[model samples]
Target: MAEFESPIVMPKLITFLSSLLQRAAESNDINQSHQSQKISVFHGLSRPSISIQSYLERIFKYASCSPSCYIVAYVYLDRFTQRQPALPINSFNVHRLLITSVMIAAKFMDDLYYNNACYAQVGGISTTEMNFLEVDFLFGLGFNLNVTPTTFYKYCSYLERGMMMLQPQINMSESSLYMGISSKLHLSFNEDESSQSHHQQQQLAV
Candidate 1:
């Protein structure tokens, strides 16, 4: 029997994961190709139409699986990448990978998950494709699905670090925008003062 895990920690990890997947989906091929050069099969796959963020949010909104499912799915993804360097997550196949990883995770972590056909509908892929992807993904990871509590929290801490790194970039962008607005406001204030001075001069002359 699979170990029961808590879902409480999943939300924060999901947020971190959503950001990471979005960045990965939007990344160019140069770096990804270099990383997964050995996985030539991925090069032939077509990119999904939806953005990773939108797709993940859709899953979160509609999927019946608990939050821990996503956290476990993230672990599977990391392990898969480590085990299969050639098949690293890239834009071309990221959507399929996300769907497969989460579905497998749900099956492993939550005993009451929907089957591949149901997941297929959620993923916008056919049942056959879903099954194929599941098999391929499992083989890719060598079926390493069991995550201990300690390992789970360790993964959580890694994601927390990633979130911290990302937050600063966001803050910096917001700070720059605030400064731009401040500069514009200051210029507007200077113009207002100049206009008032001109009016005062006119009043004095009159």
Candidate 2:
């Protein structure tokens, strides 16, 4: 099995993931798809002022979970969005959704991770709120937290392809990078997911 990636890779992963998410949320904001959307547990009364990249950076720097947790958390978010298509990833709810997703992913994927209270602190919400988010999110996911190796590989492959597709306008102002994923998840991929441990540090995405 391949060894885990060096800790040096975390920042780049964080940066790349942030850019992709920011773009997704912005696109959703423009669509404003669910104008009559009922307030779900993930929605905030108002959108947060913090940019998506900065919010993700705060979680990465503070949550400090294994590098793979970021990717796993992203998978969780995709699942959640699929499970609840009415509630897309928009600016208003993205911050809370991020904290909740990352927290759950860290718990499921990491042997050692901070508690909900700690995650809440990092996410600028109360521990009670974090707890609520977790429960609601789990139920939203129908309690499916286990990410199969095949599924993980498929996501990584698609993200890399998406990055390649969007490679033109990529500013990459920061030296850091990690990878891409989706707001649009229906795309097909030709990668062989029948390879590698999901926990192994992958060169493609975290």
The per-model lDDT (C-alpha) reads: 0.60, 0.68
Per-residue lDDT tens digits for candidate 1, residues 42-126, read 3335777777778887787667886666656776776666667666567777778888889988887665878899898998888
Q: After aligning candidate 2 to the native by TM-score, how far in Å is the CA of 165 from where it should be?
A: 7.3
In candidate 2, what are the lDDT values of residues 1-206, reduced to their tens digit? 01123343344556667776777677778867545444787788888888888999898878888666776778777767767767777778889989999998888876688999999999999999999999999998898777665565555655444444455364332212232222212223333423433323222231
TM-score of each model, in listed order = 0.67, 0.73
The global Cα lDDT (0 to 1) of model 2 is: 0.68
* C-alpha lDDT of residue 30 in model 1: 54
Superposed model 1: Cα runs more than 4 Å off = 1-13, 25-28, 32-45, 161-206
- Among these predictions, the greatest TM-score belongs to 2
